[model samples]
Target: MGSLRINKVKYNGDKYYFESPVFTENVILIEGDNGTGKTTFCNLIYYGLGGRVKEFLKEEARTHKEIVNDTNNYVDLYISINTENYHLRRFIGDNDITVSPFTISDVEPPTPNEIETNLVNLDGVELLPVNRSFGNRIFSDWVLEKLNISVIELYQGYSTFKVNFTELFRLIYHDQQPNPELIYKQIDTKSNYISDSELLRKAIFEQLIGKSSSEYYDAIVEAKKAEKEKLLAKHFLDEFEPIIAHLRGAEKVINKPFLMTELEQKEMQLEKLHYSREAFKNNRTANTTIDIALDDSKSIIISDEIGLSESKEKLLSLFDEKSKLFFLKENTAKEITQVIKVIHAHDQLNLFSADTCPYCLTKVERVSGHCVCGAEIDEQQYERFFYTSQEYKEILKSKTKTVSTIELAIKGCEEDITSVNSDIEQLTNNIQNAKKKLRSILDSIDQPIDIETLNNIDDKILSIREQISLLNQKIELENKYEKLSSEYEVKRKAHQSAELIMQGLEVKAKQEIVTKVNDFSDVYNLLMTETLEDCRSARISLDTYLPVINDGEYKEASSGVSIRLMYYLTLLTLSLEDENVPFPHFLLIDTPETAGIELSNLKNCLDKFSNLQSISNDYQVIITTGLSKYPESLANNRVIYLPNKANALLKTKSQSQPL
Candidate 1:
C-alpha cells in the first residue's frame, strides 16, 4: 500500500495559498533554482502526508528567539489519492498541536475516517512514525517498506558514501555542514533523555559485581593491572628485603664486644699471662732492691725482696706498667741488678734460690742467673761492658714493646666485627618485611574467589548469554511459526465471517494487492536502463533486500531520494496494468532535482518514474525539483513560483527580536 497523498494545500490567516500539483506516475519533476523556497514547499507537502509538520512548527515556535518570529495562525491540506476516494482534511490553527483537529472526508475513493488520537488500522499496519524531520521517516522507514524488505539488513549491508549529516542535509536541500553523529542512522536512534551506554553498564556492574560484558572486561583489566603493579612492587621488595633482613639479624653479633676476633681474644689471653707473671714476680724470693746512696757513685743494696715495703710498693703501684717494657737487666749486677728488673714485665730469675737457670743449665745460680749468663762476674769485669749492657737493655725493651703493641692492636679489631653483625641483623629484619609484602601482593593477584563465588558469576554470564542466544534463535524460528499461525488464524476467522476470502466473516470493501501490474519485461527494461550491469526484474521479491554490488554488499533503502523513488515506483508498478490497489495511486513528491544527484542518473531514474503515469486517467504522478523539466505528455502539470523578492542566494533572514 502507498502512503496517503495530498492534492491541494491551504492555510488560514496567511498572505497567499501555496499550491503545487500532486504527482502520481513512474516519473514526475518539480523544478526551481537554489534558495527558491524549494525546501519549504517540500516540507509543506510532507506535512500534508500525515507527517508531524505543525508539531515541528510548534517546537520551533517555542525557541528563545521565536518571540520575534511570525506565528502560524491556521493551516489546512486537502488530500487526493484516489479520484473516487476520500479527501483528508488536516487543520493546525491551534498553537498547541496536542489539540489540533484533523479529519478524513469521503470524496471518491472510500469511506471517511473521523476518529482521533492517531488514525491507523489494526494488525500493526499503519503510517510510519518519523524520528527526525525527513531523514527518519521518508528515508529510513518509507524506503524499506517500498522495497518490501527490512531496514536493518539494508543498512548493515550499505556500501556507498557514508551517511553523515553534511551529506544528508545536502541531499535534501543544500545548506551548511551538518554534524557527523547527528546524521541519524538506525543505530543512532535515541530518545531525548538518553543515558550513556558505558555509564549505565558501570552502574550496573557496581551493583551486580561482574555480570555484563563491559563489567567483565573492565573488572578483569582493572584487577590484572592493579594486581600486576602490586606484584611488581612486591617482587622488587622480595629480592632486596631478604638480604636486608638477614644483615639486620646478624648485626647483633657484630654491634659491640662480642669480641670474637682471634686477635682480640689473643690480646685478652696475653693480659692474663702478664698478670700471672706479675704474681710470680711478687711472690718470688729475690734479691730485693733497697738502694741508699752513700758516697760518690756507690749504693748499698739489700736484695731478697719479693713484695716490697709499704712505701716502696706504693711507689711501684703508682708507676704505669707500660714503662716496664723499656727497662732491662744491667751489667752492674750487684749495683743495678737489684733495681734493673723493677720496671720490667717479667722475672724469669728465681730470687734467693741456688737453682739452675730455666733457659741455660748453670749450677747454684743466684743473682747471676737473672742475667743471660751464669758466671759470677766482678763489677770491674762488667764495667767496660756498660755501654754494651745499655744497648743490650734497649734491645730487650724493644722486644717486649713489640709484643705489648701487638696485643693492644688486636683489641681494636673486636669493635669492627660488632658493626658487621649489626648490618646482618638489619638485613634480616628487611627480609621479613619483604616476605609480608609478597604475600599481600599474591593475594590481590589471584583474587581468591571461592568455588561458590566463581560459580555465581559463571551462572549469571551464562544465563544472560543464553538468553541473548535463545532470543536470536527464536527470531529465526519465529518466521515459520508466525506463517503457520497467520494461516491458521485466517482459516479460523473464516468460520466467524461468512463472506471473508480467507477467515473473517465481516463484509468489507473488496480489496486486492496487485504486486506487479506492469509487464515484467517492461519494468525490467526501464530499471536496467539506469545500470551498467545487465538487469533483472526490478519488482522486489518478497524476500529481496534491494540492489547490491555482490552477494554481500547491499544498497541502503534509508536514503532521502532513493527511498522516495522506491516507494513511488513500488505503488506505480503495482497498479500500472489494471490500476487496482489498496492505497492511493497518485504521488506528490517535493523538489528533489537539486539534491546534488548525477544529472544522467536522475534523468534515467526520472524516465523510469514517468512510465508509472499510465496514459489513462487512472494513475497520476507529480514531483518537485530545483531543475525544471516538463515532460511531453505531462504539460498540464502546474508550476509554483515562490516570491524571489531579493537576492536568490541569501538565507532567510530573521527579524530582530524585541527586548
Candidate 2:
C-alpha cells in the first residue's frame, strides 16, 4: 500500500515566519476561531500537494491582505511518501512549485532562521509547473509517480481525456463548500477540462477502489469497433444479395450445360448447311459444263438454218429466170413460121404471071420478061416484094438459133433449182436434229438451289452464339459472389470471438466490484446510524455509489453533512481493511460542521474519524474546526491551537510579535 504523511510545514516571509506544530499523529486537529485562518492552513497543504486551490487562495489574500501581500512570502511543506522524505515550497500567487529531496532531520521542527537559510540556498531543486497549458513537466507527474499511481485515460463521447491527480484529490479533500449533499468536490463549471458527467464520477470511484483498469476499458473499445465492422459486412452482404440472385436466376433460365450443348448443335447444323450448299454448287457447275456443249450444238444448227434460207432464195431466182427463157423460145418459133410463108408466096406469084393474069384470068404475053400488068419478074423486084428464098432461109436459121439458146438457158435454170432444193432439204434436216438434242440436254440438268435457306441458317447460328456469351458473363458474376460470401463469414466469426472476450473481462471486474461495495456498505451504514439523530437505515448505492438514506434519495438537508463525512470515513476505513482498495489512506477535511449541521451530529462525525484511527494506524486524517466545537475526546489529537482572531495562524514578525 502507498502512504503520504506530513512531517512539517513552515511559512517564510521577508523578515518573519510562522511554522506549524510537527504532525506526528495519524489524526491531527487544528482548532481555531472563525477569523484565525484555520481554512487557510488547510488550503496551504492542499496547494503544496499540487492541488488547484487558487480560488481559495484569492479569498484568503482578500481576507488577510497585509499578511498575504508580502512579496517574499511562501509556504514550505516537508513530507514523506512510501518512506521517501521530500520538501515542497509554493509561493503566493504562483503556479510553479519547487520540489527536492530533504536529507535534514524532520524529527524536530526547523527553526525560522534555519528554514530561511534553507529556502535561500536550496540545491538540486526541480521546478514543476502546475498550469496545464504549459505542455511541459507538470507537478502532478512528479507527485503521482512518487505515490506509485499510473495516469489513467478515459474515453467519453468522441473525446478521450486523462484522470489527473487534481481530479482524484477531490475525493480525498472534503472542502468547506456550502453544498453538504455533494459526495465529491463540486465540479468546477468554469473549467473546460472538468465534466459533471456521472460516467466520469463513476470512473474516478472505480479507479480509487481498484475496480477498473486501462486494459479493461481498452477491451471494451475494441469490442465496439469489431461489432461495428461486423454490421457493415452484413449490410454489404444484404445489398449484394439481390444482384447475386438476379445473376443466379439468369443462369438458371439459360441452364449452362444445356446452352453449351445447343450451341454445339447449332454449329454442326451450320457446317452441314455450308456443305450442302457446296454440293449444290458442284452440281450446278456440272450442269453448266453440259450446257456449254449444247450451246455449241445449237450454234451449228443456227448456221445450217442460215444456209438453208440463202439456198431457198437462190432457187426462187433461178425459177424466175427459167420462166423468162421459155417465153422467148416460143416467140422465136412463131417468127420462123411467118418467114417461111413469105418465101413460098413470092415463088407462087412468079409462076402464075407467066401463064395468065392471076387476078383477071386473061391470056397474057411476057414483055422483057415481065407480066402484062407491069410486074417485074427480075430478082430485084422479088427482093422488094417478098423475101427471096435464100433470104427467107437465112432468117429462119437465125430464129432457129435463138430458139436453141432459149432451150439451153431453160435447162440450165432447172438444173440449178434442183441442186438448190436438195441442199435446202439437207440443211433443214440437220437444224431439226440439233433442236431435239438441245431440248434433251435442258431436261437433264437439275433445278436451281435455294439461297434464302442458307441465310436463315446463318441468322440462327449468330443468335445461339449471343446466348452463349451472356451465359459466360453470368458465370463470372456468380464466382465473384462466392468470394464475397466467404469474406463475410470470416468477419462474422471474428466479431463473435471479440464479443465473448469482452464479456468475460467485464464479468470478472463486476464480481470484484460487488464484493468491495458490500464491504463498504457495511461500514457506511454503521457510521450513518451512529452519526444522525433520526437515522433509520443507511447504505451505499450499488449503482451510483452514493449514500441512500432510509431507502430514499439523498436530498438537501443539514444532516447531509454528517452523511458526507461518514461516507469519506468509510472509504478511509475500507482502505485499511480491504487489500484491493487503492485509496491513499489519507484525508484532509476542513470544517465538517458547516451547513448548519447539529453540534451533536458534528461530534458523532468527529468520533467516526477517531474510530477509523482506532481500527488502523496506517492512515492520516487532518481536520480543522472551531475551537468551541472541538470534541473533548479528540483533544489528544489536536496539533495546533489559535486562541482568537488576534492570534491568527500567520504573524507579521516572528512568533514573538503579532501583526
Candidate 3:
C-alpha cells in the first residue's frame, strides 16, 4: 500500500490566509481549547482524503451559511503518496476538485482574487470530478487506485458492492465525537457500497494482512463432496435393497445373471394360458342358457334404465340449487338483523344531547343564545339527522327485495325437485321388474362351465409371471449396491482430510490476531499508570475490536477518552509493527482529553505516541487535544495552540476586515 502524508494544509478566506503546521515528523499534536476548530481541522484532513463529511456537519453547514465562522472559504491539501507529491484543491459548494502536478513548495498562498473564483485551476491539473452514481464509483475508484489498494469485489459482478477508500479511512481517523462501544464504528455509516458490513470488515482485515479471500471456501468444497458421496450410497440402497429382500424371502439368488432367462420362460407359459382360456370361452360360453336370459332382460329394460339415469341427474341439479338459495336466505336474514340494530342504536344516541359536550367533557354554551354547533330541537330541521334515517330506510328496502327474490327462487327449486323425484321412482320400479324377469329365466336353465371360472385360472397364471419378473429386477439391484458402497467409502475419506485442513488454517489466523492483541495490551498499560482495577484484565475483543475488561466492554468505563486513547493507540501501534496487518499506518485522532483523564495520564499517552514514532518513519500520527489537558511532556510536540475563543481556529471579522 502507498503511504499517505499530508505535507501542508492551506485555508483561503476572502481577506486572509490560514496555514497549518509544516510537515516535520511522524507524530504531530494540535493543542487547543474547546470550539477551536480542532474537529473541523480533522474533518478537513478526512474530506481531503475522500472520507465522508459527517451528516451532522453537512446539515449544520446547510442550515447556517458559514461553517466554523468561515464564509466562501475553500481548503488546499498538499499530500504525498509514496514518492510522488501532489497539491489537491477543493472549493466550497462544489462536488469537484483539482489535483495539480506540483510539490508542496510550488503551492503558494492563494491571492484574494483567486479565493473569490469558483474552483481555481492551476496549470497541469487533473480534474477529479465527483460522480453522483451508486457508490460514487468514479471518485472512489480513482482514490483507491492511487493509494495502491486493490479494487476487490465484495459480491462479485455487483460493481457497487465493493470495499471503498472511505471505509479504509474510517480505521485511520477517529473524530472528536465519541463513538459507540464498537471499535469499528467508524465505518458503520450506511452507504450504497458495503451492503454486508461484517463481510466487508473481514475482507478488509484479510486484504491488510495478506490472507486469502475466504476460509469457508475450502470447507464448502469438502462438504459438497461429502454430500455427493452420501447421495451415491443412498441411491444404491433405496433402488436395490427392497428388491433383494423380496427375492431372498422366495429363496432366489437375485444377483444371478441367469435370472432374466428364467423370468422369460414363465412369461411365455402365462401367454399360452391366456390363449387357452380365450379358446375355452369361445367354444362353450354364448351357447349356454344364461346368454339367452341376459339378451331378453336387456331388450325389455334398456330404455327404462336410460330414463332413470336422466331423472336422477335432474333431481341432483334441483337439490344443489335449493341448497344455495337456503344458505343465501340465512345470511341475508342475519345481515338485515345487524343493520336494524345499528339503525336503532344510531337513532337512540341522537335522541337528545345533555347540556355538555361528550368529547371534551365540558359544559356546552349556546353562542348568542342559539345552538351554534347544530344541535336542533326538531330533527326535521337538521339535514344530517334526516339523511341518516332516510339512508337506513333505503337499505332496509333493498334487503327486503333481495329476501323476496331468494324465497321465490327457493319455491321454484322445490317444485322442480318434486317433479324429478316422481320420474326417478317410476323408472327405478320398471328397471327392477326387468332384472327379476331375467333372473327367473336364468334359474330355469343351467350351464355347466362358466366364463368366470376360466378367467380366475388365467389371473392366477398372470400373477405368478409378474412375481418372476420382480425377482429378476431384485437380482440386478443386488449387484449395483456392492459397486456404490465401495465408491462411497473412498469419497468419505477425502472429505475428512479436507475438514482437517480447513480447521488448521482457521486456527493459524486466530493465533496471529491474538498475538497482536497481547502487544496492544502491553502498550495500553504503559500509558495508563493510574489504571482502574477493572482494566487489569482488559483485552481487545476479536469480534467487535473493542476493549473487553473483566468480560465487559471498555467503552462502559467512567473515563471515556482514556479508554478511547488506549484503543486508538493500541490499534495504531500494533498495525505499525505487525507484518500481517495491511494498515495504512496513518492515524488522525481528534481529541484525547474528553471524559476527564488525569493530566499525568494524558502526558503519558502523548509520550507513548512520541516513543512509537521512533520505531518507524513509514507512518504518520496526528493528535488534537485541549491545551490544559496535557502536561509539559507534550510542549515540544504541540504544533498550534489556541489560548482563547477570540483567537480560535476561525479568523474573526475584526481580524479579516481591511487588515
Candidate 4:
C-alpha cells in the first residue's frame, strides 16, 4: 500500500547503527555540500530495494551501490502505510534471499531477524504473494459475494499483468498521462508496427467499453426474477396437491349422513329370534315352531324384554348355538350391537338409532377430533334415521343368508369408494395448490425458473458459448494470418526499405544520431571540467545501424542511428514492458552544460533527451550544477546547487577500505 525503504544504513563499517536526519520535506532535497554521500544514500536506497544501480551508471569504477551489490551481507526494507510500520530483512550466507519476509512490529526497516537461504540463482527471479492482505486501500474481496476483480475498480480499476487501477496511482505520482505528445512518441518511437497493433485494440476497448464478460452475464442477471418465479411454480406443484386431496376426502364424509329403518331393525330382532329358536329346538322337538313353523307368517316377532347375545351379530355364527335371542330394534346395525339385558320396552321396538361401540369403530369426533367410538354422540346424527331399506322376514329362511352376503358386498364396495374418492380429492387439491404456487412464482420479482425452461436456456447458453468459442478460434486464426502477413511484409519491406534508404542520403540520419549521442556526452563534461576550453567533446559510437550499415575499413566506420532506434523503440513498446521495473517519469539529468562550449550543440542535445523525457504528461527536468562551472543561459529552470562542501556521510563502506 505504501513505499518501502531499505537499509538507509546510516552506519559506516564498524558503527552499531545508522541514524538519519529527519526527512522533513517529503520532496527530499538530499544535498550535502559536495562529497556528502547524497549519491551514496541514493545507492543504498536503490540497492536495498533490489535495484541494480551500477547498471545505470556509465563508469566501471564502483559506487557503494556496486559495493553493496558485491559484498553486502544484509538487506532491509521498511513499508509505511496507515501511519504504521512493517519491515523485511535478508542476510547473505551462500547466496539467496528468504522467500517470505520475517515481519516485525511498529518499527522502521532493516529488522534484525533476517535469515540466509544459501541458494544461488542467476537465471531469473522468484515472485511470491505477500503474507498480509492489502488493507490500506478502500478495496477488498470481502465487500462482494464473488467477483473477478476487487472493489478498487470503482475508483481505479483492477490490476493485470500490465496496467490497472494501482498502476493508475503510480502514473499519477509520476505525473504521467496519455496525452497526445506521449501517444505520438510511443507510436513514432516504436520500430515494430505489429507489436504496436497486437493486443492494442483490446486495451482500447477495455478503457473505452469495459467488461467483455458482461454481455451474457448481464442478460442472465436481468432475467433473475423470472427465473426464480419459475422455480417457485415447480415447487408448489410438487408439494401441496396431495395434502389438499386427503383433507377434502376426509371432510366430505361429514356431508354424507347414514341412516337405518324400523323394518331393518325388526329383521335384526327376527334373526336373533331365529337363533334362539334354533338353539332351543336343537335341545328338543318343541323347536318345531321355528324350523317347521305352523302358521309362522302371523307369529308376530315379539319379545318380553328379550336380549341379544354378544355373538349373535355374526349372522351365521355357530359359536353361540346354545345362546338365547333378543328382540333387538331393527334400526340397530350389526356393528352397533352392544351388551344389554333387555332389548325393548315397547311392543313396537322402542329404540333410536343405535351407536357403534367406542373401541371397535375408529370414528373421530368432529369438534374435539377424538374418535366417536370413545366419545358420547350428543350430536343430532345419533337420534336421526331415514327409512332407506327394511325387511321383516322369517327367522330360518335362506333369503336372510343371501341378504347378509349382499350387505357384506355393499360394505366392501363402500369402503373402496371412500378410498378412491379420497385419492381423487387429493389429486385435485394438488392441482390447485400447484396452480397457486405457479402463479406466485410468475408474479414474483425473481421468478423461479422451470426445470425444463432452465435446461432449455442452459442449452441455448451453451450454444452461444460454443459459438463464442468458435468465434475465438476464428479470431485466433485471423491473428495467426495477420502475424504471418506482417512477417511477410517485414521481410519483404526490410530489403526494399533498406536498399532505398542505403542508396539515398538517408544514411546521413545515422550521422545525425551519432552527433546527438556525442552532444549528450558533452553536457556531462561541465561537471568534471574546470573551464569551457577544457570541455572539448568526445564522439559517440554504436555497434549497429538502422536502415544502413558500413564497415568502412574500421577507420571512418560510422556508428549509425541504432542508439536512437533502441531508445525510440523502448518508448514505443513501453506499454508492453514488464511494468514492475522502475522509471522516473521526469529524468534526473547530469548534463555537460558548462563544457559543451558550443551553445548550439548543448541546446541541440538538450532538445533531444529533454524531448525524450518530456514526450507528454507531467515530466520535468531538474539539473544540478555549480555556479562557477555551469553556464547561466541554460539554467532556465530552478538549478540546485551544492552551496558549500564537507557535509557528507557514508552509511556503508567496504570492510577494509582506506578512504
Which scores greater on lDDT, model 2 or model 3?
A: 2
Candidate 3 differs from the real structure by a C-alpha RMSD in angstroms, to one decimal, of: 21.7
Error of 3 at 28 (Å): 1.6
- Tell me the TM-score of each prediction against the true structure: 0.32, 0.54, 0.49, 0.23
Rate residue 45 of model 4 by lDDT: 40
RMSD of 4: 39.6
- TM for candidate 2 is 0.54
| lDDT of the candidates, in the order given | 0.35, 0.71, 0.62, 0.31
User: Model 2 over residues 1-659: C-alpha lDDT tens digits?
Assistant: 56788887777665546778778889989888887878878777887787655543546434446445565566778888877777777766667676666555643434434554432223344657776663465888787677766566566665555667777777888888877888998653335443656777777777677634433555676676676777887887788878867756644444446656665776676577666645543223355568687889889898998898899889889988888888788778777656544433332122333445667655576466564667667745633543333445457668878888888888888888889998988898889888888875665466554547756756665775676566556655555555667767887888788878878877776876787788888888888888786788888787998888989955458988988888888888888887557788889888888889878768868976767655778788899998768677788888788889778887767357432
lDDT of 1 by residue, 16-60 (tens): 333334333333344556656555555444443434433235355
Candidate 1 vs 4: which has more TM-score: 1
lDDT of 3 by residue, 1-659 (tens): 55677877766544445577676778778877787678767867776665556431445534212443444455668877767777665654445555554532434544334443422223344546554454454556666667666666554332335566666665567665554344453653566555446666655554444333234333534555565676777676667667667656867444455666667777777788777765555323345456766887887699888888888888888899899999999999787766655543333233333444556545566443244475445433533433343356458568978999999999999988888888888888888999898775555454345558777877878787777767556655655666666666766676677667757755765676566556666766654434443455566556745566656643343355566666666666666676445566678888766555667666666666766756677888888888666656556777777766666665643474111
Candidate 3 at residue 256, lDDT? 52
Clashing pairs in 3: 208-582, 254-475
Against the true structure, whose TM-score is highest?
Answer: 2
Rank ordering of all candidates by TM-score, starting from the highest: 2, 3, 1, 4
lDDT digits (tens) for residues 1-659 of candidate 4? 11222212333222222345322221222323445444444444433333334423435374444334543234444433223332322332211221222223323332213212221121221222211135432111211111222222211122112222222221112111223112111221232333244233223222211222122222323234233444455455445445444544553322111212333444455455444433332122233333333233222121101112221233223223212122121223332221111111110122222433334432233443222345655455543431101111112123435446556655665565455456545545554554554443334323232445445545555555554454454444445444555555554555455445433423443344344334333332332122222323322233321111121212111111112222322321231122211222222222223322344433443334333333332223333322333333344432233444322343333222211
